[model samples]
Target chain A: MSANEEAARHREVRNAWALSAPALILLLVAAIGPLFIMLVYSFLTPGQYGNVEWKFSWDAWIGTLYSRDIFDGTLKLADAHLTIFWRSVKLSLLTTIITFIVGFPTAWFIATRSPRSRALWLFLITIPFWTNLLIRTFAINEIIRNEGLINSVLMWMGVIDQPINMIYTDTAVFVGMTYVYLPLMVLPLFASIDRFDMRLLEAGYDLYASRWQVLRRVIVPIVRPGIVAGSILVFIPALGAYVTPRILGGGKNMMIGNFIELQFGQGRNWPLGAALSVLLLIVVTIALMFYVRASTKGTNNG
Target chain B: MTTDVAVEARNAVKAFGQGETAVRALDDVSIQIRKAEFFTLLGPSGCGKTTLLRLIAGFETPTSGQILLDGKDITNDPPNKRPVNTVFQSYALFPHLSVAQNIAFGLEMLGRPRAEITKTVERMLALVKLEAMAGRKTSQLSGGQQQRVALARALAPQPKVLLLDEPLSALDYKLRKEMQLELKRLQTETGITFIFVTHDQEEALTMSDRIAVMSAGHIQQIGGPREIYTRPVNRFVADFIGETNFLSGEAGEGRVTLASGDVVQVEGAEGRKGKVTVVIRPEQVRLAEAGAAETIPATVESLVYFGTDTHCHLRLKDGTEMVARLQSPASGEAGLQQGQSVGLRFAPGAARVLED
Candidate 1:
């Protein structure tokens, strides 16, 4: 090629590299690099100066495999961790199921409305998202506290002789997590249900299917992918929730998140905390992968 | 007294909106569809043909009317309760179901015995020539296959009346023509009343035993395709059903005088003593050699040739443009060229007086 053509090719290559470098760097720093560090920490042992010791050993894995901490009262065993993990899973699952029950109908209702009404409903649902997460959590905490509005109302109505302790429980964690993640669940559900072809429902009606039969056979299958996506959005974050559980749950109903934070902060065991974080990551990844694969199969079958 | 009367709508009226803002979609319209015949509702868009079909299918309630199927009023029934099924314009096949499942859907809805449903579904698949594709998914099927699946699914239950709303409009020209023949055969074989809605006049003309031509929420004419086409009652039906050349004229007594001073006897227009339109088809205009006797003097304005025939556009001395289709080399070479002076004539009964 001529000199100018060669020069143009070089410029094109350089410009392409320049445009893609930032995103590549971001992926490496935010995802690949942290994962690599976590893998190394999973193998390392903690040193005296609150740092990881440079060594290659199966000590942390073995420590995780066996029940040393629970025996010595320094840390908890598999049962404690497993119990916490199961509780987290159950809470997150409940949140997802409840969110779908509340959100699907709301999304379908909004989607079926006129465009003006749809916009107003979407705006109302999104308004809570504009507030800071901390403020929203604190607001819920105040509303459901022992001396808060709910207890006060019950006292005035003579429904209770004493104020009910509503906050600082697993129920409080669920309420707070659901409130925080309700919008995240709703938007995707709305999008998927909006894309549903309304004519298919009419076809179902013409075929002699009752109203509920149409819902089961037509509407639900068509919106299954959205349900899966929305559940993942709600469940994954609810599993690893720290602030909501910490504030609304206080210290009584400490979830796996609080346990991990305790290992890293008060326990001063870097490797153990990293190990717990890694375990949480694996559980979430597996659940999400299974959900995605199943929902994809559902979409294809449809 | 009339066991053959399959569907009857009495003074059906459907209005949109409410009160003063309302627009009448079906204005006191009534139609009777007999059993074992192909009836077509032909009209332009916004003419309420599809609305009328939906009313029969029980998808929409008439503002004020009675819809009877087999001597029982079904106007208050929901779609699922009615004895009718519709093949939608978009097909509306269950996207999640296979071809067999889609066809078997209606049978399943009827709470039929499983073995009987299977037999009927298989029979329908064979009827639509889609037996081989029954195992395939609906989304994987081609448009023609989907069309056949929709047809089979609607027919499987053997509804009292089958309503098709522009079912063949989505297919290509060749497939549409093929489906038209297949549908006629299917109707005859099954002996079911078919009420089909279409805006294409050729489709109505080719497939229907009778046609109801509608315009502006009213039935302008209803008869056999030939009767509706050849004996249209108004200018809209004349222009809508086929191409027509309109000549403005003044009518008094039994004769109408064209602007060119040619007077023709138009029966049934005796009392119309004001401005009127005389409608004539282009093919009805006969071309003659220059200076031919009893022919109006005209000049060819344009010539368009097809493989089978040639169309000659002419302007009379009074500047009224007309077109004539000439077939064969002898007829085409009757000395006609652009801007060439010629003569034009029509038989006495060819043109009809019309009101808009």
Candidate 2:
């Protein structure tokens, strides 16, 4: 290459890096810096009063799946910790599924509205976001509690003499997370469905495809990117959700987020908390990788 | 109930919206398409041609009338329940499916066996001459290839009747012409009843066995191409099919007297009374020297030279403007100029009289 061309190319590369330097520095300081600290803490010894010491040890990582008997120091399965992890993964998966079931039709309805009124329907979907997430979770807490609107209405109508116990259960946590993460699922679905060609439905019907076949074969495959985006958006945050479970499940239905908080705040095991936090990050990264694979496959086929 | 009639629409009316703001999209339209014939619904946009085609395809149900397939009342049948397919104006091939898969779609939906669907898909690919493109996605194909895939997909199931709603309108001029002939060849080879909808008059004339010219939700006329072109029943059909000169005249006793005081014989003016519109095609009018026998005096307004023909714009003495298309000479000259006086001669029995 000519020297002039090489010099000009080097200047362009320098300008690009110079423009991005601020973002790169901010990311290193504000994001990865704390994760580095957590990683280091996960390898160190936990102090007595909820802090980590400089001495390296593997006890915190081992304690993630096992705990020692206080008397004999025998390593055994961490039953309580495993239950919390299972509940976290299970509830998060169910929340993703339930949100999709409810959000698909809602997004389809909003996307099919008249152009002027479609804006109104989409605005209504996002109205829940204007309120604080904590307040919203608490509001759900009021509705499903023993004296909540559903039980009150059922009792008033004489359908049942006693209120069904729905609070402080896994069901309550499930309901709460689904409500909290529903809009996240719906918006991406709407963005994809809004661009969907309605004429394909007619074309499908003309081609002898029933409505159900059309949905499965045509609509679902075409809008899969939205499904993946919405799933990841709901799944990752729901896996790490804390406030909704705390408010609705009372004290027993602890998710991973609440369990990790317990290590730092009251359990006095900072290193274990750091390790659990790192584990959650790994789970999220794996989920993101699956999403990337799925979306790329969809593009390749299309 | 005749076996030759493939599809019949009886007084179909389709209205959009309700009450005060309702728009009548198809107004009491009735048509009978014969078996294995290419029938065209030709009109300008919003003229209800597409609506009629949709009614035949069962995409739109009639509001107050009946649609029949082989004497069976199919007005209430859903599109998927009917044995008919449509090639949409947009050629809405599923972008996710490969070319072969697209052709196999309708067959698969019909619950055809795997081996049969594969055989039919291969045959359809060969029919449309796209065998080499079977593995490619619909989005990867060119416009013409996508169009062929759409045709193959719609033709795979061997529907009793096929509907095409301006399928070639998206193509360029050259490709549109090529597909027109290609579509005709497909229809002939398959011997399927083809119901085509388009607004281009030349396309309808070139490709259809019969043409139904529509206007404002009404069928103006229905006949073969030659009949519709040479013998339109009214002014709308005459003006829409091609260029025509409408001269205000009074008709009686096998001849018509123009407002310019010139008398000319009209083919269909026999036994007609006063106040008629004379329909004369541009190609039927011949220009001669001024004051020739049986010729009307006119002044040449302008001339437009197309490759094969020269359009002579002329004005009658009564101030009525008319156009005459004359064959361009081999020497590349029309031998006519503006503002020159000329005699306009109508070939014997060239004019048809329409009631005013």
Please report the candidate that would top TM-score against the real structure: 2
Per-residue lDDT tens digits of candidate 2, residues B1-356?
A: 23499999999999999999988899999999999999999999999999999888888888889999998999999999999999988999998788998899899899999999999999999999999999998999999999999999999999999999999999999999999999999999999999999999999999999999999999999999999999999999999999999999998778889999999988888899999999999999998999888899999999998989999999999899999999999999888889999998886577789999
Q: What digit string (tens of lDDT, one per residue) describes model 1 on residues A1-302? A: 99999999999999999999999999999998988898788788877656688887666665553456546556445676666777788888999988888899889988999999999999999999789999999999999999998999999999998988879988999999888999878899999999999999889989998998788878888888788889989998899988999999897687888877886677666687778778889878997888888777764334
RMSD in angstroms, all models?
3.9, 2.1
| Candidate 1 CAPRI grade | medium
Residue A126: error of model 2 in Å?
1.6
Chain A structural similarity (TM-score) per candidate? 0.88, 0.93
DockQ of 1: 0.49
Interface RMSD for each predicted structure: 2.1, 2.1
Cα error, residue B350 of model 2, in Å, equals 1.8
lDDT of 2 by residue, A199-242 (tens): 99999999899999999888988898889889999999999999
For model 1, the TM-score of its B chain against the native B chain is: 0.95
